[model samples]
Target chain A: GESVGLHLPTLSVQEGDNSIINCAYSNSASDYFIWYKQESGKGPQFIIDIRSNMDKRQGQRVTVLLNKTVKHLSLQIAATQPGDSAVYFCAENWSGGSNYKLTFGKGTLLTVNP
Target chain B: DVKVTQSSRYLVKRTGEKVFLECVQDMDHENMFWYRQDPGLGLRLIYFSYDVKMKEKGDIPEGYSVSREKKERFSLILESASTNQTSMYLCASSSSTDTQYFGPGTRLTVL
Candidate 1:
């Protein structure tokens, strides 16, 4: 079946350091992959997304890399700050048509120590 | 900005009781979805609607049903709330793009 998984469940990093979170997806037919940030007591917010055809995509302070060969995906956060502490989720767009139904992985909790 | 709002942030219901989880979006998006977030299971899609009065069963829709009589409002119903169904329910809305905006999840506890 189609599923998305993460390499780590929790990650701790010092402020100003870089953070890397890894994910693996089983569905090769997924058209797009997205990263979301869920703060405490809040909903998951869209951070960035990359199409399946692309190797990488970048946002303001974050980057998403996609490797189709190994079915691996990763998110990198630069200058990790206290405000960046949240549970991060990676999702795959399984429904390719007008509907964007996604399969989300078990989130990775990121804690930044100041 | 696309704003998806859920009716409740937390709910408590007894077993065998019917529960209604309501969601509304202000973006006028054509697609709305309901998902349950469990501890290690991640977010599992329960149901989704593409248009008013039209719905589709998602990955996990056995104990749940949905209604979309209005374009902006989507509701998830639990026929008989069970102990295993205690989880965070999230609602989301999306346009033609692949991105989806999520609402603050409803943490429902079934006792």
Candidate 2:
């Protein structure tokens, strides 16, 4: 789904299951993309990032897939844990911008059930 | 590891009063930014500083200003705070080429 505002699309997963969060960005020129996890009462924490050149990147138990043609990004989490319950944000960076600032999407609150 | 620190986790302010939010980074990053998070509005850029003494306005910078006197610190200023400004302010820092490291965040309530 598109990022309309502060509303983040959510993904619910059972413990020990895999979870996938999706985001669709607006800028085609964005060269880099990053995903973040923000727990309640805390700020957004960096999870993983991918450069536009690469369609897919893997991390420790996590993977990021980029579809430039669709301007979409997804985060895959393995073996979901309750600790994984938090709002996840996807950010895009266009190197052409003056500040190279990242544009953040609303976010997806992933709820992992134990 | 990059560590970004904010002065306050929560704050209260009155309308028409000035407000300041401070952010510091230990990574000696050259770039720092300020953003506001609101319900159903996502995170919007307020301002950013690319280097000491250099600052730029982001998309929604009409009511905010920024200062970066040193490479490690960035401050956001509200000339005349308004209730509409009530939201979660996040501070972030990045080197010339790296991911942004965020602070815990500052929740400001304007009444």
Candidate 3:
């Protein structure tokens, strides 16, 4: 019954603009959440992560926000560039009982236009 | 730098043939995982190993098997490759349950 899903399947953004990607998760027991970017012909790369105890975490040009009450997570990219075009995925770490596994979402395709 | 490397970037095999996909990590991680990436389905876990000689069935592990004979190396085996098995296979390693470093996935095509 544990699943993660994105609000949109495709997002088209102009270069140098900000982009916000949203995700909703079903499992409240999930303790950790991560965002990953996968470019064409490449593997998924870790962008950022936030723990259940933390509400927000920031990285270079990227921010991850976690809202435990609504079971929502979001990734914001500032000044989005052409290189930022990729499929983004949100994963949750299920730490219930003795199980430790990372479950991935369906992913969102982000296209940056010049 | 933490590095995870797969044996091949791309592979092509015929149906009913046994396929072996190898992965090795240099970070001395205790956890290694194998996942299949498909369109719209995202990354589905096929198998995982917590430590040497230990294995666990992930969300989808029907047509695949794994071997973790060493700490740094993990292998995924396809007993009889099928057309439906043609998908990108990704290998990842993590020291803890938090962050997982992924290797450039192998695009496997079963002809």
Candidate 4:
């Protein structure tokens, strides 16, 4: 079965440094991808998303890059802060009907040191 | 803001007990979903409802069921809770074409 997965399970960065989280998806039919941030004791919050038509999309201090050929996706965060410490997940939405259900990666735990 | 709320933040139930987890969304979205998150397992969809009185089984729906009596509410039910059912359950809602907004998840422990 095709699945989405992260390259790293944990990442540690210092404050003000740039951070990157990587994901690889196996389903070639996936047309939409999203990044989510989950703080401790909370649900995952939507961060940014990109459609397969575009390779890159940017949101407030964050960018999502997609590589359809390689079936890879990545999320970049700028000026990492202590508050940014959390688990980040990447989800792939395959092209289909109106269900809009997503397949999520296991997630990467990000730790930002102040 | 799209706010999705769950009935409880933490719940503990005995084995064989019936468990119900309620979720409500204020955005009046047409789609709602239930997922269980476990360590190293990511998020597995339990069930989803696209409209009132309509339901669909998701990837992992063997031990769970759902109810969507109203447009704003969706509920997940465990017929017979077991220790293996313990996990963090999350609820989300979205329009047919919109991104999903999630609730503060409910941590369930079946002892």
Q: Top lDDT: which candidate number?
A: 4
Of 3 and 4, the candidate ranking higher by lDDT:
4
**Alpha carbon lDDT at B61, candidate 3:** 100
Output the TM-score of candidate 3: 0.97
Question: What's the ranking of the predictions by lDDT, best on top?
Answer: 4, 3, 1, 2
Residue pairs of candidate 1 with colliding backbone atoms: none
Per-residue lDDT tens digits for candidate 2, residues B50-80, read 9999988887999888888889999999999
Off by over 4 Å in 1: A94-98
Q: Each candidate's lDDT (Cα)?
A: 0.92, 0.89, 0.94, 0.94
Model 2, runs deviating above 4 Å: A1-8
Best by TM-score: 3
The total of clashing pairs for model 4 equals 0
Q: Which candidate is the best by DockQ?
A: 4
Candidate 1 lDDT, tens digit per residue, B1-111? 778999999999999999999999999899999988887787888999989999999989999999999999999999999999999999999986758899999999999
- CAPRI-style quality class for the chain A–B interface of candidate 3: medium
Q: Please give, for residues B1-111, the per-residue lDDT of candidate 3 as tens digits.
A: 789999999999999999999999999999999999998788999999999999999989999999999999999999999999999999999986558889999999999
Model 1, A1-114: lDDT tens per residue?
778999999999999999999999998888799999999877899999999879999999999999999999999999999999999999988655437778889999999999
**Docking quality band of candidate 1, CAPRI definitions:** medium
Task: Give each prediction's DockQ, rounded to 2 decimals.
Answer: 0.79, 0.82, 0.74, 0.88
